[model samples]
Target: MPVELVALIGLLVVFATTTLLDVNMGAVAFVAAFVVGSLVAGVPVERVISDGFPAELFLTLVGVTYLFAIARDNGTITWLTSAGVRLVRGRLVLVPWVMFVVTGLLAMAGAPLVAVIAVLAPVALEFARRYDINPLLMGLMVVNGGAAGGLAPSSVLGSLSNAVVERNGLSIDPGLLFAGSAVFNVLLGAVGFVLFGGSRLAGVRTSAREPAVVRTSGPGATTAPAVAGSRLNGHRLATLAGLVVLAVGALAFEVNIGVLAMTVAVALSIASPAAGRRAVPQVAWPTVLLVCGTLTYVELLQSLGTLEYLGRGVAAVGVPIVAALIICGIGALGSAFASTIGMLGALIPLAVPLLGDSTLSATALITALAISSLVVDASPLSSTGALVVANSPESQRDRVFRQLLAWGFSLIVVAPVTTCLVFVLPGA
Candidate 1:
């Protein structure tokens, strides 16, 4: 049997084990990568660790979760939730849109997609619980918002995608990519709002509040909210400042989100070790493991030429329109599991041969590619999606995971077709 086929089978088996036996998908994937990389592919475990392991994402998951864990324990999150509600005047329906727009603007302004999602997801999920809004809807809005805004010309994705297009010698406007993604996600957000109970949010309102003061009496302990809408004490104030620093550093300076988060989290921990130690248990280790393992295995597939093998098939199609759809399909499917920026770099160039022929509209095809690739960032496996799952309240995590899994895979089918019909077919 082909090694690629075996690796593919191993992936399916990993998912099957997760669904059936309730095992951590990350552990199963790690074992699969080991078995396949070592025995079948003749690659060393050292190489997989160095080459396939998503060290950056690991830092991100641990840092963001740890930071937010502190925020949750200290009542800072609760305070922010109330502040957000007040900002929106307690009209529940507006809350998700606020999250969507804020993240969108941040992404459009050039924060990395992961950075935007990481900072906002925890706060957004709090709004979900506080207002009884659908957590899936709230989470996905943030994901989509970040993805949509990330397509702008100044953004990382836009820069990378345009560079690839220039290298591939395709004549396409960068603005079209941003416009297409923005429109698609806005429509998608509206659909999610409705489907995930957005209509119920109308006229719903809650009072604006301040952080209730809470204090620690001894080591490894904390008091509950002492007052509602009261002045935040020193610890919560310091934590909030750390969050501000995280947002500013990540967005304005383009610092590594994970590293910066770790720095802030560690600093806060040092300032108040006992209270900070309390947050260590709250880090989302399982989610960290799940995302990192999945990406490592995906990296193995990439190294083994599996994606290139599929890319070759895309170039061989006789019909331009059909080939265009296939490219979008592959982009969505691949981006769902891997990095969005990575997918843009990997998949868009595959259309070089077809686009080289000048038989397809570069605007429609490239826009379709961009939008299709990014719309799936809501998938549980993708960075934006995983960030959401990690930051979510414990009770909502499982439900968000299932919903995103279904939505992500479903988009693999739906987004490609929709983009093709809306963009490609019109031109064809």
Candidate 2:
């Protein structure tokens, strides 16, 4: 078989197994890509391995994740969420939109997963209970919104993608990424909102009731009032103030996010050793591992001329509509196992080659990624879903998880399918 055909088959196998068997799709793709590249494509294994680990991207990702962890540990993000909820009066119908904006901003600020979620989750729950709106809906909203954040220019996802694409001799246009990401975010957010329903939001009210708060003694816990006051020294205040500046500078000035994030993480870590150490685990290693593993595989596959051959094979079929749907479906299912970045790594290697003659633009491919990510990252199998369940009241967590699972599938089905038919087909 031709290298392209082999590569396409390998992609299909990975996607199918990920969907059916619940395997780690990234690991599958990594193994498959290397085997095919060496045995069939005649690429050297050493070169493939060396090309896989894009160091600059990984460095920035780790640094930003670490810094975000620090913010989570310090309860900085929690305070932000409280402020956001207060500003909105905890309205059920408005919370999703508010969260979309807030999380987007924080993500742009290079806040880590736990930092953003910790700040937003508690407030969302309070609003859900108060308004009698389904907590599951609110949870999905938060997760989807975070996925949007990851796609933004300031996000680790965006930075990594930009770096990868650039290394492949593609341009890294931050403005284009920003614009494309905004479209993806809006469409996915709207789909999540619609599926969750506005009617479920009826008759919800908020009063002077203060929501229950979780006070852990670890990094994220609030300090005693007097202790907090006493510890508010100039150095500590300067570090906190620097974070605010970092957030604004990155978002408003369009700074190189990786550099900005590393600067913040390193500076803050040096400023307060105890706080930095406490925040490390909140960095979301699973996400990083997923991205790295998939990227490695994709790099190997690219070396084998798989994409070029696959493009010709796909063009031979000449049914753009059906092809688009199949790709989107594969992308979504793969994402369920590997998450968004991983899906992109696995699928794009085949997709780019297969759709070469078709009208599918990089933007359309990105749209598929955005929707797949929104669905799978919010699925019960994903970290976002796990966090939602873990953070919900113990009595309601199980029920909420199941509900969110259903709602998340609705997104997986609707958003990706719709984008395939509407966006990809029209472009093709």
- Give the candidate number with the greatest lDDT: 1
- Supply candidate 1's per-residue lDDT for 406: 96
lDDT of 1 by residue, 191-298 (tens): 988899989878877777554545434333566764455458787899999999999999888899999999999998999787677778778888888888988988
Model 1: lDDT equals: 0.85
Point out where model 2 deviates above 4 Å. 11-34, 101-188, 194-240, 317-428
Clashes of each: 0, 1
lDDT for 384 in candidate 2 is 53
Candidates' lDDT values, in order? 0.85, 0.59
Give candidate 1 misplaced runs (Cα > 4 Å).
210-228
Deviation of model 2 at 211, angstroms: 9.0
* Top TM-score prediction, candidate number: 1
Task: Please list all clashing residue pairs in model 1, or write none if there are none.
Answer: none
